[model samples]
Target chain A: MTETNQAIQLNQVNYSITGELILKNITHSFPTGKITTLVGPSGAGKTTLFRLCNGLISRDSGEIFINGKSIDDYDPLVLRQTVGIALQSATMISGSIFDNLALPLTLKGEQLSEEDANKLLELVGLEKSLLYRNSKDLSGGQLQKVSIARTLVNEPSILLLDEITSSLDRVSQQDIEKLIKRINENYGTTIIWITHNLKQAYTIGDYTVVMMDGEVIESGPSDLLHNPKTNRTKKFVRGEIE
Target chain B: MNFLTLSLSLVFVFIPIVLSKVLKLELEKDTIIATVRSVVQLLAVGYVLKFVFDSENMIYILLMIILMIVAATHNARKKGTSIKGITWKLVVTFITIEVVTQTILLGFGIIPPTAQYLIPISGMMIGNSMVLSILFLNRFTAEIESNQDAIELILSLGGTPKQAIHTQLVNSIKASTIPTIESQKTIGLVQLPGMMSGQIIAGADPVQAVLFQLLILFLLLTTAVVSSALLGFLSYPSLFNERKQLLKKITTSTSDTEKS
Candidate 1:
C-alpha cells in the first residue's frame, strides 16, 4: 500500500535496549480509519512498538512514517499530539476528573470549557457528573475511562491502546470495547490496539497481527485467527502455546 | 577548646556505652566506633584547617573545596543507583552550589577571605547542600518509580520532557527542602544550634554570636533551594535514555534491600 493510504507505515524498524533486540526489523502498515489489533505473549514487544509509533521511544534503525512523513521529520511532541497513546494503568494527579480531562489542552496553553469536558466524559461512557468528582475517588474502571477521555482531548488522528481493559472487570471491558468501536466508526479514527486475548483480537480487529520474540509472525484479517497460516499462529490462537 | 576540656567530653560517649551494656542492647561496639571515628575525623580536619589557614594560598583553598564536593557527590550518588551517570549529575549540582555560595560570600565581601572565616562558612554551605542533594535524589527516584505511568501518559499526549516530569520534579524538590524551611521557621525557639552554642561557650558576646549564626542559617536556606532545584533538573534526564524512553531498570523491587 502507498503511504497516502496508510495512517502509519513502518519499514525495517528495529529497536533494542541495553544491547538486547526488542523489535527486530519490523515492517508493516496500519491502514487509515481501521482497527488493527496487535496480539502476542508477554515480552513480545507489542507495547514497545506502540511507543515507537508515537515517538515516545525511538527505533534504533530504519524508518517509521506517520501520514506519509518520516517520524524523525516531525518533533516528537508534535508527533505525539497526532498519535496519542494510553497505557493500561495510568495515574491521575490529585484533582477532579475535569482537571485530568483538561490537562492536554492546558499543556498546549489552551483551556477546556466545562461543557466540552463533559462531552468527552460522555463519549468515553462516563457520566457528566464524574467531571466534578475527585479523580482519587474513582474506581479502576472509571479511572481508565477518564484516561481514555483525556487522551481523546487532543483529537489525535491515530490512537494507540496498550491492553487498556486488562485490569478492569467484564462489564468495564465490554463498555470500553463498545466505546472504542464507536469512536473508530463515528470519527474514522485509525486505532492500533495491543491485546493478549486472541478472542478479543478476532472480535474487534479488522486486521490482526501476530508477534513473537520481537518479530511479526503473521498478519492477516481477523479470520486468520481461525485459519492461521503458520504453526506458531495456530498454537497461539488455540491457547496451546504462548 | 583545650585538649583537657575536649577529652572530658568522652564522658558523654562513656554514658551511652555503659547504658548499652546494662540494657544488653549490644550497641557498645557501634557507639564506640562512631565516637572514635568522629574524634579522628574532626581532629584531622582541625589540623588540615590550621595548615590551610597558615598557608593563605588560593590553590589550597580551591583544592579543599573540590575535595569536599567530590566526597559529597560520592555520598549522595548512593541514593540514586537507578539513575545512570548519577555521580556526575551530583558533582555538577554540588559544584554549582559551591561556586554560587562562594561567589556570594567572597564577591559581596559579606565576610573576609581569610581561611578562618572562609573555611567554616564554606563548610556549612557545602555540608548543607550535600544533605539537600541526598534528599533530592532519594525523593526524586522514589517519585519517578511510583509515577512512571503518569509521566509516560503525559509524554504520549504531546507534553515535552519538562512538562512530563514537572509534577515529580516539584514534589521532589518540595519534599527535600521542607525540613530546611520548617527548621528555619523555628530556628531560635526550638533549640540553640551548634554554631551559636559553640560561640557562646567560647566566651563570645551573646549578640555577636547570634548574628553570625543567623548568617549561616540564611546561607543554609539558599543552599536548600538551589541544591534541590538544580539536582532535580540535572538528574531526571538520566532516568530516560537517549531516545527519551523511560528505562525499565529504574523500578526497585518491593523486597529490594539497601545497604545504607
Candidate 2:
C-alpha cells in the first residue's frame, strides 16, 4: 500500500537506551481508521513503539511518517494532540472528573464547560452526574473510562492504548471492548492497541501485528491469527512462545 | 563570654551523647562529630567575621557574602540533583534571594551598611533559603516519582511540559513554604528565637532584640517563597525534552532512560 493510505509508517526506525538497542530497524505500515492490535511477549517493545509514534520518545535513527507527513514535521504538542495515548495505569488527578476530562484544553489555556465535560462522560458510558464528583473516588473501571474520555477530549485521529483493560474484571473488559469498537466504528479513529490476550487480539483487531525481540514477526489480516504463515506467529497464537 | 565560659557549654553536648549511649541509639558518634564540627567551623567563621568587621572594607563584606552563598549552594544542590544544571540553579536562586533581601534591608535603611549588619543578615537569609531549597527539592522529586503516571497522562494529552508538571511544582512550593509560615505563627510563644535570645544575652535591650528578631523572621518568609518558587520554575523545564516528552528519569548527572 502507498503511504497515503497508511496512518503511520515507520521506516528503518531504531531506538536504544543505555547502549542497548530497544528497537532494531523496525519498519511497518499501520493502516488508517482500523483497529491494529500488537501482540507479543512482555519485553517486545510494544509500548516503546507507541511512545515513539506519539513523539513521547525520539527514534535513534529512522523516519516515521504520520498521514504521509514526516512525524518530525509536526510540532510535538500538536502531534500528541493529533495522536492521543492512554496507559493501563488509570491514574486520576486530585480533582473532579470534569477537571480530569477538561485537562487537555485546560493546559492550552482554554476552558471546558460543564456541558462539554458531561458530554465526554456520557460518551465514555459514565454518568453525567460523575462529572462533578472527585475523580479519586472512581472505581478502576470508571477510572479507565474517564481516562479514555480524557484522551478523546483532544479529538485525536489516532489512539494508542497500552493494555488499558489488563487489570479489569471480565465485565469491565468486555464493556471497554464494546466501547472501543463503538468508538472505532463511529469515529473511524485509527487505533493501535497493545494487548497480551490472544483472544482479545483476534477478536478486537481488524489487523494483527506480531512482534518478538523488537522486530515485527508478521502482520496480516486478523483472520490470519487462525493460520499464520510464520512459525513464530503460529507459536505466539498457540500460546507456546510467550 | 570568655573561652572558659564557651568551654563550659560543652556540658550540653555531653548530655545528648550520654543519653544516646544509654539508649543504644548509635547517634553518639554523629552527635560528637556534629559538636566538633560546629565548634571548629563557628570559631573559624567568628574570626573571619571579626577580621571583616575590623577591616570595614566593601570588598571584605562582599567576599564574606560570596562565601556564605557558596556554602549554601553546595549544601542545597544535592537535594535537587534530578534537576539539570542544579548547581547553577541553586546559585542563581541563592544570589537572587541575597540581592532581593539585602536590597530591601539596606535600601530601606532598616539595617546599617556595616559588615556587622550585612554579613550576619546575609548568612541568615542564604541559610534559610538553602533549607527551603532542600525541602522544596525533596518534596518535588517525591511528587514526581509518585505522580509519574499522572504527569505523562497530561503530556500524552498534548499538555506542555510546564502544564504536565504544574501540580507537582505547586504542591512542592506549598509544602516547603508552609513550615516557615506555621513556625512564625507561634514565634515568641513556642520558643525563644535564637537571634533574639542571643541579642538579649549580649546585653541588648529586650524590645530592641525582638525588633531585630522580627526583621529576620520577615526576611525568612521572603526566602521561603523566592527560593522554592524560583527553583521549581527553573527545574521543571529540564524534566521534558524538546518534543515535550517526559523523560522516564530526570537527573542532572545522567541522561534519562526511557521506560520500556
Candidate 3:
C-alpha cells in the first residue's frame, strides 16, 4: 500500500458500543507537521476516535490509514510506538519517574541511556532531580508531563493528547501548551490534541475540527473561529451553548 | 457418651447458623449446602480409605495417590484458569512432591512402606502441596493480571517476561509457604499436628513419633515450597503467549467470578 501524504486519514469510520453509535461515519485527514485539535462536548466520541487510531478499539466499519498505509498493516505494538498517545487520566506505573519515562522505549526494545532519558526529561520541563521520585508522588500536572515525556521517549512520528491539560491550573496548562508547541515546531511531530477548551484550541491548533453527536460540525483553519459558517459552531465558540 | 454425642451434634448444627446470623452474612444456604456436600464426600472417602488401609495392597495405595493427583489437578485448575496444559502441569507437580516425600520417608526406614504409614503421610503431603499449589497459582495469576502494565513496562524496558514477573512469583511462593512454616513452628507447642498424634495413638513411642513427625513436617514444608513454586513458574508462561500478550482464554469457568 502506498503511503498517504496525510499523517492520519479516516474513511467512513464508524464505532459503536452495544449497538449505540459512538462515532458515526466520519471522514477526515490530519495533515503532517500540523497541530489538529478535535473539539467536542462529552460523549462526542473524541476519546473513542483516539482508540480507533491507536487500534485499542476496532471500528464497526471504516478504514484508518496511518501515514498512508492501512493501520491493519502495522502491528499494534509498532503502531503504538510510532503513534504515541497520552491519556487524559494519566496512569503511572507504581515506580520512579525514570521507569515510567523509559517504559515505551523499553517495550520497543530501543536502547535508552541515562543521558538520553535525562535529556528527554529536560525537554518535558522536568528536572533531573525528579527522576528518582516515585511517579505516584507526583501531582496531577507533573504526572501528565511525565506521561508526555514517556510517550515521546520513542520519538514517535505522531503524538495524540487526550485532554492532557484539562485538569491543570492556568500556569501548568500554559506551561504544557508551550512545551507542546515547542515539540511540534522543533521536532516536526504531527499532533492530534483533543480538548473542550475552544480558547486553547484556537491558541494551539493549526487546524480545528469541531464535532457534535459523533459528526463533524465544521472544520477549517484555526483562524476560522473569527468567521464560523455554522450557527452551532458560532454558539459553541461564543459559549452560548455547550 | 450418648449425652456427649447429642451435645456435640447440637453444637455442630446450630453454631454455623448463629455465627452466620451474627456476622450478617447472606451465605446461609451456600454454607449449609457446602457443609452437607463436604460431610457426604468425607464420609464416602472415609469408608474407602478404611478399606484401602485394611487391604494393604500396593496397587490400592498407588490408586489412592492417583485419585489424590486428580483432586489436586481439579483444585489447581480452578485456581489458575489462565494455566494451559493444566492436567499435565498438575500431574507433574503432584508426582514430584509425592515421590520426593515418599522416597525420603521410606529410604530413612521411618515408615516401612506399610499401608497405614503410606496413606496418611501421602495424604498429608498431597493435601498440603495441593493447597500450596492453589495459593501460589492464584496469587501469581492475579498479581500478573492486575499489574500487567507494570510488567509490560519492564518488558519494554529490556526486561524479559520472566525477569519482570520474578518478584511477583517469589512473593507468591513466599505467601503460600508461610502457613506451613508457621504450622511447623507451632507443632507440639500450641497444637499437635495430625501425623504425630495419629502415630502416637497407633502404638508408636512418643519420642520416636515426635522425631518422625518433625521429619515429615520438614519434608512436607520442603515439598510444598518446591512443588508450588515449580507449578507456579510452569503455569505462568501459559498465561502469556510467545509475543507476551496475555491470552484471553482461561481454562476454569469459575475465573470470571473470582476476577469480579
Error of 1 at B21 (Å): 4.7
Q: Is candidate 1 or candidate 2 better by TM-score?
A: 2
Interface RMSD, per-candidate values to 1 decimal: 7.3, 2.3, 7.3
Docking class of 1: acceptable
TM-score (0 to 1) for chain B of model 3: 0.81
Pull out the clashing pairs in model 2: none
- Give the CAPRI rating of model 2: medium
Q: Count the backbone clashes (under 3 Å) in each candidate.
A: 0, 0, 4
Report the number of the highest-DockQ candidate. Answer: 2
Query: What is each predicted model's overall lDDT from 0 to 1?
Result: 0.85, 0.88, 0.78
> Sorted by DockQ, highest first, which candidate order results?
2, 1, 3
- List runs of model 3 lying over 4 Å from the truth: A16-21, A57-61, A105-111, A213-217, A224-242, B1-39, B54-63, B69-122, B133-189, B215-260
What are the candidates' individual DockQ scores? 0.40, 0.63, 0.13
Q: Summarize candidate 2's per-residue lDDT along B1-260 as a digit string, tens digits.
A: 89999899999999998999999999998998999899899999999989989999999999988988899988988887777799999999999999999999889999989999999999999999999999999999988887877777787888788888998999999999999999999988989999999999999999999999999999999999999999999899888878887775663222332333
TM-score of 2: 0.95
The deviation in Å at residue B186 for candidate 3 is 4.9
Name the runs in model 2 displaced over 4 angstroms. B251-260
